[model samples]
Target: MATALSEEELDNEDYYSLLNVRREASSEELKAAYRRLCMLYHPDKHRDPELKSQAERLFNLVHQAYEVLSDPQTRAIYDIYGKRGLEMEGWEVVERRRTPAEIREEFERLQREREERRLQQRTNPKFSSRGIRPGLTTVLARNLDKNTVGYLQWRWGIQSAMNTSIVRDTKTSHFTVALQLGIPHSFALISYQHKFQDDDQTRVKGSLKAGFFGTVVEYGAERKISRHSVLGAAVSVGVPQGVSLKVKLNRASQTYFFPIHLTDQLLPSAMFYATVGPLVVYFAMHRLIIKPYLRAQKEKELEKQRESAATDVLQKKQEAESAVRLMQESVRRIIEAEESRMGLIIVNAWYGKFVNDKSRKSEKVKVIDVTVPLQCLVKDSKLILTEASKAGLPGFYDPCVGEEKNLKVLYQFRGVLHQVMVLDSEALRIPKQSHRIDTDG
Candidate 1:
């Protein structure tokens, strides 16, 4: 049965009814609806080349709507406020068109700012973003003739990333390197730090040798945790490797200082926290933006290395075509396997969050991205459905507990029509439920 259209959908027309779903539907209902419509309207499943683009646009809209409304909170906000809530919340929503002149001006301004920061650091070394006098600061004092003498050593190891704190009161170059020296027995340490490449991302940093000759390095990745906030984690190594950890917390803020605009600052009360098993500690706040473009460049170089491997293999005089093929296949598998090792969303993503702490949540996401291989999609849906129905065939699980769900399979079974849904926890198999599906040209 077709669902009723809401007031907003009625006014918008244009398949808007097909996009927004009823808020009261269960998770399974929503998923079923999405999977059904996606397969039915998928442009790739159609042959009329002219209709392909139009179908693609509609598919994208439906997919986007499902992504938002499938989540409870986002659906509520959209229902009450429509697109306005998304805009105010900094969502990746469409914006009003900007004039050509305005667009050019914005780009120019960004370029100028980048150049200015680069020049400023070169000329005035001490003018750090964190507002600290660069260079070394030390003190030598004697106790009131107490038959002993005392001295103090204080050094501000300012380089780049650390030169500016999150407080906006400082200016940072890209990275920061620092070293300190005081009393040989106690005051000596070395430290290094860097921030994330993206502003809406997390900051990573580390410090070690602590007093004058310690080494520290850290890496951080950003993820959206909730509507109003973002979260991330970092791994580090150094002199204080197991002892010291830096916590960076940043928040967004906007004010009417001049023309309307948006900006973010490190909250004054922002807490810097770190824990060593049972211990917990906190410090005051600060801010800065790290760049990731450099990392992408390095990855490109790695790609070149992979491409060059085949040439190296070919150089062997005894090499055979079979050996070359085997090497290539092995390399492909290695690259895919590495995804699970790095805990990223690529090769091993189908394993459902192998490295994630929350297994259930990750598994649900992974299921959505597992497209049926093209070979299966070209056959009969009934056979595919029956095969997918096997319960203990491995790789299948009730990822979302308490929900009666089915895998809306779309694949080939014996070179015939294949599109079906099945419920099999051990092996999600699908069988043709109706004769409506068409898997031919």
Candidate 2:
């Protein structure tokens, strides 16, 4: 049978229907029903692809229903709290003789905690920058004789200009104030200096620096260029002398500093240089840092989705098993009521062909007949029918390995006779007979 149930159907499943047993069935009866169902729907017995798939699914459902209904404790829990109740942690507490009120309180507490966590996650930020360090840099430089200049710089935030630094120099012993602006593809920096040197040739010096696309240019009454290439240049102006330009070119293994003085004594100097080079540092950072981080995040999300899917499947299975139990109880009640009212009863039922030493071509298929056996089993006082294997009856055999079969019961109440059909594995329930008085009689 293709017994895969939808979500709603699983919630309403009848365990009795799944096991084909009465609600009042004893443990032995339940086990027998489970075994029979297992044999009928075992995936290995089906040859068709679709039927085998369905059998595998149905086989799992049968096992689940049997596991719950067969356990005394779990079955009791299921009867009261249902699928959701069985999932509670208090189930273990039940074994320690905890009161129902205590168990309920614990469940409520867990629910509240879960809700609070969810709300906190939604209302609060997922990512925060509290107490996080921003940026850091260290510089070390030595002057010609014994003089040295070095500093440590630190800045924080992308849009804000916040920085603190400590400077060391022989001729100057004063603090510096700086402002900076950074955006995508561009950045700018401005700084004011107050030197405490005795000369005071330039006590207050200001500098402005800007860069775009790896090309940096600076000015402080003297123009400088830190080009995308390995060459750097700075221009300085003197009072008596004209303009003096200094260029530094970095080669594979050495750096050449060329200072050309274009005073009133020399000719004007104009220079132009350009080259295309690879952004190896940027590519290396993406390969080593950003790419791996993004990949890890994607894998984590995929794992979470897989876990959620597994949880959903498990919940559906539990609901399906619970549905079967409910259905069994319903059918059991119906059978008991029919039997108590002295209504029709089922005897031997046949669902396949019957051969009577007859013609070779004669065959019966897809039909059930129980008229003769029911007539013989009925009594004037009372009727009783014990559950038996449907295939054990004479002139009966399973037609196909995974084919569905049903039973036809011959019933008579008062003087009206009727035939009712039901799944061969289902409990029998007879319809109520209506009595009418004849005017002539």
Candidate 3:
């Protein structure tokens, strides 16, 4: 029920839809869209009172969406947590850096917790709703100064108990000491973890737990053998229950548990999730979610890096423009010569990053018309660029700076429309029938 509400809330409002723009639209794109919409719906532009009022409303909405989505900070929150995030309180404190998916996860968790509390309120007295988890729900209270939290828990049908724990969280490990009453069976756990990389790409862990029932010690080591799966083994010993070993093969949230008893007295048990229990869950989550989130974050970082180097890129673009200016006279001569005798005429040429999709892209996409440069390169009704980067050419620039590039050409060979796309580091040979854009060859 809570999950459904959260999903519904997520789909509620979209700023991109209001702006009639893609979510990936840049700041310049947002401004252009806002201006265009503003011009079309300026209220004063309409003569009829009803039409003016309607335009006013639309203009207000467009302005509001533009205001929220234009600011970088608010836009980031809007992108991650939706429109409500812009109005939410805790989000104001942007102290910690988090990914979009991470922020969404936190926001959803808070919403779920809030829903749980709401359910708690309308239930037990009227018994209308039983909360989310069905059991004794969640956190009763917490003292942040002392780093302690209290919990009331219920088991089976009627078993009830309560406990309070003070926690210590550090960079490397977590320690918690809990005190319980009412038929208390004192329990404690200690874990050790060693990591090879700073980001914890490879790790080994061991833990010991002691309770009224028995004392159990577990030892395990896990390594990520592939992007999707982790290879790990754990050996555990319990005083009364005996010893067992487990081999865990976990990949993309699919869990495999194998438990093999080391002692004959212990008997054969399930093969998975021994002491490697929590670790398997971690890897499953990392593979299924964390990988994609990290990849997206990396792309964002690269974009930011590119933005920071805009000055250098701009300078290079100026140089390329100057080179193009120098070749304009020769290019015009080539075009006239081609048109005079039905030779290949460079109709239009764009050099830079391009998408594979057939839909029209934003005007702000990193692309520049290199028609002049390309026209000058044409010879004998054919244009052939060498097997090297075109960026080093006299009249070409790396429009996208640090990104892969493509050369899209629309040319008329024997007065027929034809187009070809050539990759940045690949050779280009044109005037071929494969690039024809007409029914008649």
Candidate 4:
């Protein structure tokens, strides 16, 4: 390779290759390689003009490499998220970083999240209510398996109603058997819906129905207008009632429809109604009333449970602290040995209640600092915990007693600062980039 890097290679940003060391190389190893390269490439050692220029270029490249890789924090940041991470605004919270695989995964993850937010913007749902009319309706559904589902709906009001349906989904088709209530509508019906195309851009479906709604058949399709809107059309050809065309416009969770009956002359009829189901009401109720009530009720129940288990929890917490005190001496020995070499180190750790939880609703979140215990648990720079509940681990206790528990850890592995939060029931394996904290080093 030439002493002077080409524009393309500079853009490629493969500094480790120029340094002649592996990505996982130790800092001391990298320092040694940098020194050797500098000694061989120093401009002052060259005699001829061309050699001096080449040596100058080589020495400059070597110096840049040393500047980047010599510092532990900068090197870790560069190794994980790349140079862009070093320049990004608010890099203190740049979503996440991984083991030198951040850019593609981060871009893809953000794209998916943005698409979901555009499509599922239901914070203010425009619910379509099909005229509730002071009636009581109950619905129950069960998923039989991956491909089959059954439903039962019962409504009592001016007219009694009971309906049952069993639906099965195949690769590109859906089959449904329905049992309706009234005379002609009471007949058993089988319906089939075939999807011609279903993807991000377009969704096309053709359906055939019998029994409750006569021998009706229709084909409908929805096409993406943009991230937040969709346009749809459906054409139906029935027996005596003739043919109909429906045009639909969908914006987020809200949908508008215009239905027209096609006469013999192929013109539209005056029977167009643009009303949607009253689903927004339920969403509003859930957001405005239901969630707060449920949360308050949960807190009340949790308080009662905690009060009942107060004494036991206190005893367990004392025991955990005692266990942590006993572990400090051995943990210091382990940390000293770990520091001598480059490996994983427990910078901070806590168990029981979550340390990162920012909820202000509860004043007391009982977490035991288990940094010593965790350091003792680390073997050969790797920390592994069994699949069983971590509450049973040494130096751990049920901080919230009757509530869910989490273990929060902040650790440095080979110089990279990483943080993770794990549920009590989850197994733990340290130094995985998937659990890396979204913070600047």
Which scores higher on TM-score, 1 or 2? Answer: 2
Candidate 2's C-alpha runs over 4 A off are: 1-10, 95-417, 420-441
213-252: candidate 3 lDDT, tens digit per residue: 7888778777765457776778777877677887787889
TM-scores for candidates 1 onward, in order = 0.21, 0.26, 0.40, 0.37
TM-score (C-alpha, index-matched) for candidate 1: 0.21
In order, the Cα lDDT scores of the candidates are 0.37, 0.45, 0.64, 0.63
Give the per-residue lDDT digits (tens) of candidate 1, residues 227-259: 244444443444433323333333454211111
User: After superposing candidate 3, which stretches have Cα over 4 Å from the reference?
Assistant: 1-283, 287-289, 355-361
- Which prediction has the highest lDDT against the true structure? 3
Q: What is the lDDT of residue 247 in candidate 1?
A: 32
For model 4, residues 175-290, the per-residue Cα lDDT tens digits are 77777674223546565656555443555566666655556656666666444777777777655455677888899999899977664232234122111222344357557875
Put the candidates in TM-score order, highest first. 3, 4, 2, 1
Of the candidates shown, which would achieve the greatest TM-score relative to the real structure?
A: 3
lDDT of 2: 0.45
Span of ten consecutive residues with least summed lDDT in model 2:
270-279
State the weakest 10-residue window (summed lDDT) of model 1.
278-287
